[model samples]
Target: MEHPALIIVDVQNDFCPGGALAVPEGDQIIPIVRAWAEDFFRQGYPIVTTQDNHPPHHISFGERGGPWPPHCVQGTLGFALHPALQLPPHAVCLKGEDPDQDAYSGFEGLVEGPEGHREPLASFLHRASVDTVYVAGLATDYCVKATVLDALKAGFRTIVLRDAVRGVDVNAGDSARALEEMAGQGAEIR
Candidate 1:
């Protein structure tokens, strides 16, 4: 039997509606994600949540000439997970805390440690014997898309819960295009 994991990507305050980089109606998906996470927890599957815990001077900030405004800065309220997201006690939180990298994918960033470990999402999933991954959360066009693609590349069966995701949609069709791209890469769009 194939085990599955739920990967909630970047459901931080900064991505919700009214935060710095608010995805329109991004907060709306909280209840849906929370319910799914709760069910997954009850089923004894692993639930992993990723957060954009960048530095104040992170390269992805517009102040540093990057595309986005300062968001999810380390130690800031914007860096915290949304108040409504009900993360389980055992839920693994992966933080993207590099100041120089724009970590759009949960699997692309390094976790802070003495050695600044490079443990990615796949490492956690594999450790839990997870073969299928169901992903949901904020900014469908960026982090969610990147995470899905990486999950597929890492040989997990990837599924995107469309209703549980919102997008920044920097461009008019970026969100739609991102979904298409993920599907093309073998992610099942539910």
Candidate 2:
């Protein structure tokens, strides 16, 4: 039987409030995520998580010629999950490993083509018989948006927990616009 999985995206320390690349009130999602994860587990639905495991000098960081601050360096404390979320020890899928690839979407890595291909998250979700995916975590306008869109494109029913997301909102309009766009793409918001 097909089971719905909770695809919790980047809930790393660096994206939490008070971290290197803090999203406003990012820590606020911890309790909600924990509760949802627990509820899903108790309901017997499998949980799969994605972590932004970037290299120390990853190109997404401003220090590495990107627009954002240096954050989520591979294996660093900042790269670990937010402490309060209490992530299950074994549910994580580490992505963004290649420094040259800037993975805004957990669906696929930044690098593609013959030499540096990474696993397609959509295919994994499909293989797992996932009919619906509940996404929650980190910046709404970037990774979360990308993942939701890709999930839809992959034909999975997608839902975004509005209260559990925090957006970087670099231009002040990102949160609202991202939500509108995702909804326009057929994702249910709850």
Best by lDDT, which number? 1
lDDT of 1 by residue, 74-180 (tens): 88999889988867744545555778777888887543333545455667677779999999997899999988998899999999999999998888999999999
Candidate 1: segments with Cα more than 4 A from true spot: 110-118
Candidate 2: Cα lDDT at 87: 57
Task: Compute the lDDT for candidate 2.
Answer: 0.82
TM-score of 1: 0.93
lDDT of 1 at 123: 70
Q: 9 in model 2: Cα distance from truth in Å? A: 1.3
Each model's lDDT: 0.85, 0.82
lDDT string for model 2 (1-190, tens) is 5478898888888998778998899899889999999988888786777888887888887877799888888779889888778755335567778888787777774312245554567666666677999999988998899989988888888999998888999998998899999999999999
Alpha carbon deviation, residue 182, candidate 2 (Å):
0.3
TM per model?
A: 0.93, 0.90
